[model samples]
Target: MNSPQTINGLMRHLRNDCKIQISGSYQKQQLTSYGYYHGYKGYRFAGNSYRQIPYSDFSEVVAVIEYDNNLKAALYPELMFIETALKNIVCNESVKGLKLGTFEHLYKERMSDNTTNTKLQSKRLKLRNSVYAKLAARYHDEEEKENQMVRHFYNRGEDAPIWVVFEILYLSDLAGFFECLNEAVRENILKQMNMFDISIDANKNLLSIMIYTLKALRNSVAHNNIIFDTRFKDRKISPVLKKWVEKETGIQNITLYSLIDYIIIVCCLLKRVDFSGTRALTLLNKYKEENQRLQNSVASEIYDHIIQNNVPAKVVGLEAYLNV
Candidate 1:
């Protein structure tokens, strides 16, 4: 193990070991506030520690850190809105087919994939058990941590409504429920959302897949993980999904490897789900301004790596798409 070092020691390490020009009380204050481990260690590398980013100054690193913080601030509330909207949609559809919206009823009538293939059926059964296990553990005892709403349902010895049930699940767990839901319910959920890809009679499962895919970014933003490099992106962007985005927005290559790509995804979803008629544009403009702010704060090369040149064009394409 290595010896523990003070913030100043970390600063010296940055200057000597990392070959970055970091000095002065202002930079020292930044290192102290953001931390040598979390902020600098995170920003110094591109995707991994081995591949160091071409940062010549501590200010550039600070710029990236600040940009990431701002990006998370900008994206998180919209993410929450989208997640809640999805939950409501799923709940509505799950209940529509049943007189009683009990979890069991939803499980049988709506949640199961109803496949005949043995392997798929086995996987479904295991997943069903997992969901039951998770819910059972959460609702097990009358602890103070449990909410009144949950306690009310539990006290009655009645299963919680599918809506309440979904409210408690993590986004990924919610994705599981969505993935297993009957095709019609999934299609209807997407239809109700007015989702661009799913409602068009194509990519019905895209909604769930999107929930699963975007969950990584959601988790990162929620937890204050690094966003400037987009290393938090967990899954490969599907070509089908990319093509849908590209075809719809007229953006040529939807790599989803840049921060702007996520903005595009959010904008696409927002355009459909946002009722105010101005929220998506507001977000887009905010993103453009933020990117420009980053550009002004850092070297052009650093800004290019962070924001990508295609971002401006993509933003234009997205705005045009939203206007349509």
Candidate 2:
């Protein structure tokens, strides 16, 4: 017979302790706590006054581990990469494609040379107007100010390409992730696809598969969707992937992760593109200060828990991909 048990104060300790070693060997210790307000029938593991259902409900605990790792693992890397890329993109003067003279009027002589006020202001206005107009049209009863602005701009309008929009939102972060890896890994990826094969059809097919893979991962992260264990959001087949696998691995229907893995391999083969290693840590610190400076209750709580626990940081650096 199994006795019912409940866990109340376990979360605090689990978070503060970086690692837990049990027995003679050590494994990554992750604490998953579930609270049932009214305890129900079950068996539970008791430690340090905290109770955990022993997971006897399943044949194994692998499923639970997979679920946790996938969502958190995939998301953190994707998020961290994207954040770093955006920062780099914004800070990198070359990418902005602007001349130093353009910013001279905005700040004092020394400061003015590096300013981005004009472009940033334009971007801010465009975003604000676009958002305000859409909302006003949908909810406001009276004639909206947006109508006047639209008439002023005339009939022509250009919407930025969806892909470009996604990139702009998180450019520096993505760049940082892509930049950090070694070149050998990337060449291995290209080699894996047999891009140098004698047949033109084979080369084309490999290229197509590579493009599709990057695009899919791009879409998932750009849209703020869950990454680890993501159901391929777009199932459009890549003939290149199908053909190459059929010829080489004798398989079809490769996964989205497989494709991104290929891109990562390619990135690694290029000359090393390490960011100032401090960027990630810097961002986390900035986030903490901003939350405190603003006195944002929720942000402060998240900052304390996430930074103190390092859950998000660990997830971003998924150890599995370390050597790759």
Question: What total of clashing residue pairs does each candidate reach?
Answer: 0, 21
List where candidate 1 sits over 4 angstroms from the true fold. 48-51, 196-203
Each prediction's whole-model lDDT (CA):
0.78, 0.33
Question: Which digits, one per residue and each the tens of the lDDT, describe model 1 over residues 194-283?
Answer: 654644436477777778878988999999999767788888887667777777788888876787787888887887777787878887
TM-scores of the models, in the order given? 0.91, 0.28
* Model 1 accuracy (lDDT, Cα): 0.78
* Best candidate (score: lDDT): 1
Backbone clash pairs in model 2 (N, Cα, C under 3 Å; residues 3+ apart or in different chains), count: 21
Query: How far in Å is the alpha carbon of 195 misplaced in model 1?
Result: 3.9
**Predicted candidate 2 versus true structure: per-residue lDDT over 14-133, tens digit per residue:** 223312111211111222221222111111221112434233222112223333234343434544464444333323422232333221211112122213556534533454444345
TM for candidate 2 is 0.28
